[model samples]
Target chain A: MFVAWRDLRTAKGRFALMGTVIVLVTLLVGLLSGLTAGLARENVSGVTGLPADRLVFAEPPDGRSPSFSDSAVSEGQWRSWARRPGVVDAAPLGVRTTEAAAAPGSGGGTGGGAARVAVAAFGAEPGGRLAPGGLAPGRVVLSARAAEELGVRVGDRVRLGPGTAAVAAVEGDASHAHLPVVWTALQDWRRLPGAPGGATVIALTTGEGFTAAASEAADEALGTTALTVDEALAAIGSYQAENGSLQLMRGFLFAISALVVGAFFTVWTVQRAPEIAVLKALGASTGYLLRDALGQALLVLTAGTLAGTALAAGAGLLIGRSEVPFAVEPATVLVPAAVTVVLGAAGAALSVRRITAVDPLTALGSAR
Target chain B: MTLLLDDVTLTYEDGGGRLTALDRVRLDVPAGTVAAVVGPSGSGKSSLLAVAATLIAPDRGRVVVDGADTAALDRGARSRLRRERVGIVFQQPNLLPSLTAAEQVQLMAHLSGRPPAAARDRARELLAAVGLAGEADRRPHRLSGGQRQRVNIARALMNDPAVLLVDEPTSALDHERGAAVLDLLVGLTRERGTATVLVTHDREHLARADRVLTMRDGRLTGA
Candidate 1:
């Protein structure tokens, strides 16, 4: 690090330029990661938050995959799953996206008229693990965002899809397909207009005896597909496409960061080749020189990445308070920063390996 | 003897056949003596120095520096030998632009795994010896051509090696500066008891050498 530290100090302009580039790239990646996670939470939090091991959806047409908008599990299927060996419990879950408005004369108006909001209505058995407490036939539980949007509180009346129900509670911040979720009774959901004849999907809690083979057999006999909570997230209509696009963008940013660091180090190593040869001739081992160069690169990368991540965290904190759906968690901040530094260092390692090929004899007659 | 080259032969691959760079070269320089080798362009003077410095291995025969046979050493061992027992003064100053004059000298000690504090003191002493005490903190770009060459000399002597290989030390200097540099090299060689091999093109500086030799067509002879 002796020579490396001095080199960094001596070449301030060049290193600072590269450092700024790294900082900006890291910032972009951090923000994008936060946005990706935030948007995903909005798109599938309702499904992911369910306290079930697996979700069983009605099998679609021969070539199609299961979808929440298209799947409908009948009572017979739910009963069969509950009776199957290794299945601890199976509860029917209804999901529908519809408009909810503050009931007339309920004093729930946002400004002058009754407030209307788009919501994902989740129907589950009353008092079940999937439903909020106090849910009943004439009552509903609104997610925090849902309650805020409809200008309603507990005990306030709201009209959902041609029926009216009193708000029993406001719990959780869960959403589905970018719409806040409102929990209601399965019977109430069935009575709504355009409602499916049965539950949209069956939430299942399996015990230790639920092997993959057993689940596969059950799925085959019941004409349904079972998925873990994470896999079920793809069943949501908007999550797969939105998450995939954001992830692809994040992937590109990581690639760009590596390439940019590689390019900078490549030029730097080439420019320092003469010095490397001189050092080698002066009895400095190749290993020593390589360590010095890599140490220098790590220093720059760590400093730049930390700065960028701090900036992103600060920005996300402010943006999260608004309705931008930005998450500021360690996974979104520190993980991206670590990835940037590691990838950048890998790029730099490839560039600095050229040091091994430098001939110390060249320093014999070569002019500076 | 501090440095000995016995019937050393070196060659490089050409398109069809091999080009002989050093042919059956034999030389010896004991400690505390200065041996000057003056040669024309392409006379293999540089090749002779390279063989003695252990930068390149001879195809045939032996090179012994401070009683260690370089032919028996691997690349890593040879590098360690150079770090601990040999010092090379390049034709061009070749001082790293990032380091100050003192740091350049200190790098030699660092390569040998010496403590930084001790290296610093040694570097300071050597810089003062080379008459660059006031300019120790100045970088290569901030120093004059003569000062840079002086720093190069101080750097090579930092480890106090048994063998010192100097190449064209006065090539870029005028008469007065070149004489002063040569004088310093001679005084240091005697004071330190180092086996010195000075390769040069100018014959004017040969008078100060304890012995003078000449190279031509890959052969050495008395000047």
Candidate 2:
């Protein structure tokens, strides 16, 4: 990389401009990746947090995929699922998005006033198989986010659909469809407005080594469809649409980064054709030239990408807890950086392939 | 002989037909001498030098550089042969804009798998030999035309090749600088015992050549 290194140093402005472009593209990709993961976590954390191997939903009409928002299961379906051979446990779980307000003139809230906070309520039997904690009637468990948003602590009176209820202990931080979850007794949940008078979905705990084929057969026999926890997240309407859009944007950014890098190197290699020819005439091998070009590209991409990813990770850390739902894991930052470098290098390879076609003879008789 | 072209024939496609650039050309340059080929613009002087330099494989006949038949060797082998035994001074300086005077020389050594820093002393020596010692760190754009040409000459000699092919080294210089370049070529050829072939149209600086030949219409004769 002797020539490659020197070229980078000598043409500092040109390389710097290219490096800056890579940095910006990588930054955009990194931020999008973090946000995507954060939103996904918020959308499905409650469902994923279920201690069940599979989630059973009521079959939809023809030509429609299974969805949590549209599916409602009855007590008969849960009983039939519990009677299956491999089914160890079948618990009725209900999901509903509603508004929660602190009781008027309550001393529990920090704001000194009752404000309606958007919340998602998950209903289960008290000390049920899914939650395992005793949840009596007229009380609800608030996730950490719910507690913070409502400015309410334990032992507070909260109003939910014409019922002023005492707050049960806020336990696990669970959320569904971008809203904080409130776990309540099955009886109390049935009394809330818009309650379908039954559980939304049945969480199933299958024996070890459970197979999808067996689950399919059971679903057919019970007039219900079932999916693994990972697959069931797609049933959340918000998760599917939101995640798809963000992923598409990230894909475009990757492609654009490759194209931008490719275009820059294409023009650079074209400009250096004469120099390459001279080197060839001096008997520098085609392999040697290729290594130099590729090495230069890799160097630029690595530096720029790492810098951008670091910037994104730093920014994510700064606001991860207070401002927004940003995840700063290795998957969110480093993996995207590696992909950017590889794709950028691939683009550069395509552009620099033109170097081999340069004739060394052109270096001989021509004017410089 | 370090450079020999025997019955070499070369042609290029032109106007929907073949145009012969060199027709059965024959030449030999023994080690420790300079053989200058003078010709008009289209007289195939460059073609002859190119064939000898192994940049072109004649359509017929053979090119033997340092006693290796380039015809039998494959493309990769021919390139290696050029690196080990041949050096070419192009019509233009053709210096890489990124490299300085000394680094230009060192690049040739690097092609032979040696570090440029390891060969820095030799690069400085060669640059000093060519009277560009003071311009060692200057890039091509910073140097004068003659100095750039001299740097080109120094780079060609960096690998200590047995055969040195020069193409119009002084075309871009004044008469004095051109004469000085010619003198340097003659002196380097004698001192290093290298076989040198120079292609040029200028005959004013003919005294330094041990022998001179003229090419007209793809034919050569003693001058």
Candidate 3:
């Protein structure tokens, strides 16, 4: 890398400009990745955080996908599933998004004032197999975010529809469809406004021996179709569309980053063609030249990417605390940086491949 | 101690046909002597230097430099031959813009897989031999044309090559500077015992060489 290192030092301004571009692109990718993960959490953490290994949703009609909003499981379905061999437990679970009112004296609330917070309430029988920590009647378990937004803590009386209730506990942060979650008794959940008076779906704890035949028999007896948990993600219409579009945009950004890096190195290699020819005439092998150029590129890429990753992490730390909906984790930060480095290196390698084509005879003339 | 081009022939593609650059050319230079090749433009003087330097493989003959048969060597072996036994002085001096006078000389050793820093003593000695001892730290852009050319000569000898092929080393300089460069080339050829081939269009520098050959239309005579 003797010539390469010298070239970088001699043309500091050009290399610096290119480095800055790499840094900015890396920053954009890192931030986008963080925000994507954060937004996804807001849309699915509630379902993902469930204690059940798998969520069973009623199959949609006419070949449509299962959805929590449209799915309704009957009590007969739950009974049939509970009685089946290899089915250790089965519980009817209802999900509903509603405006929650907090009692006065909760933090930041005036006397007799009501603070309404959006929540997706999950209902289950007290001590039932699918109950998360065994929720009971007249009491609700509020997710951390829901408790914070409603300014209510454990033992506080919160109103749901017309009835008043006490907060059982404040647990992990979980959301569904951008709304925080609340756990309540199944009977109390059915009394709430807009309640369909039936379970939204069934949560089953199936043993290893559970078979499709048994599921089919239960479905037939209960007159309901079933689907696995991962297959149920399509049920949230807004989540599917939003997540897909964001992911596509991220993919485009990655592609654009690679192309931009490739183009820069292409022009850079052309500019250094004369130098390469001179080196070749001086008995430097093509392999030596290629390694030198690639080493120079890696130096620039690593520095730029590290700076960009740090900036993204700092920015995410700040934005995550606010309402920007960004997750700051290793997957969100390091994964993007790693991808940028690999793709950028590949682009640089493509551009520098032209070095092999340089003719040393060009270095023989009176005008190099 | 040996540089020989035996009945070499080289051709290039020209307008969908072939153009002969060197036709049945033969030359041999012994160690400790400077053999100058004087020729008209387009007469394959440069082509002969290139062939002798192992930069071009002839269509039908062998270039043996310091006992290495270049005709049978692959690209890597040819490159190694050039790095180890052959030194070429380009016509334009062709100093890398990023390297200083000393670094230009040191680069030859670097290309030969030796530590550049380990060759510093020799680089400084070569620079002093070329009378650029006071300008060792100057970059190509900072040095005058003649000084840059001297650095070029010093760089070629950095690896102690057995054969040196110099291509019009003084073409870009004035008469006084050109004569000085020729004098230095002659002195180095004798002192280093290298088989030197100097290509030039000017006859004024021929007095410094032990022998002179003239070329026209890709053929050689008047040794």
TM-score of candidate 2 to 2 decimals: 0.95
A1-368 per-residue lDDT for model 1 (tens digits)? 98999999999999999999999999999999999999999998898899898999999899988899999999999999999889888999999988898887664754337867889999999988777898999999999999988888888889998789999999999999999999999999987767888899999999988888988999999999999988888888799999999999998999899999989999999999999988888888988999999999999999999999999999999999999999999899999999999999999999999999998888998211
Kindly give the stretch of ten consecutive residues in candidate 3 chain A with the minimal lDDT sum.
A104-113
> What is model 2's interface RMSD?
2.7
Runs in model 2 lying further than 4 Å from the true structure = A104-113, A132-134, A162-164, A366-368
Interface RMSD score of each model? 2.9, 2.7, 2.7
- State fnat for each of the candidate structures: 0.63, 0.65, 0.57
Candidates 1 and 2 compared by lDDT, better number: 1
Going through the candidates in order, state the TM-score of chain A alone for each one: 0.97, 0.94, 0.90
Q: Which ten residues in a row have the lowest lDDT in candidate 2 chain A?
A: A104-113
TM-score of each: 0.98, 0.95, 0.93
lDDT of 1 at B169: 97
Cα error of candidate 2 at position B222, Å = 3.6
Best by lDDT, which number?
A: 1
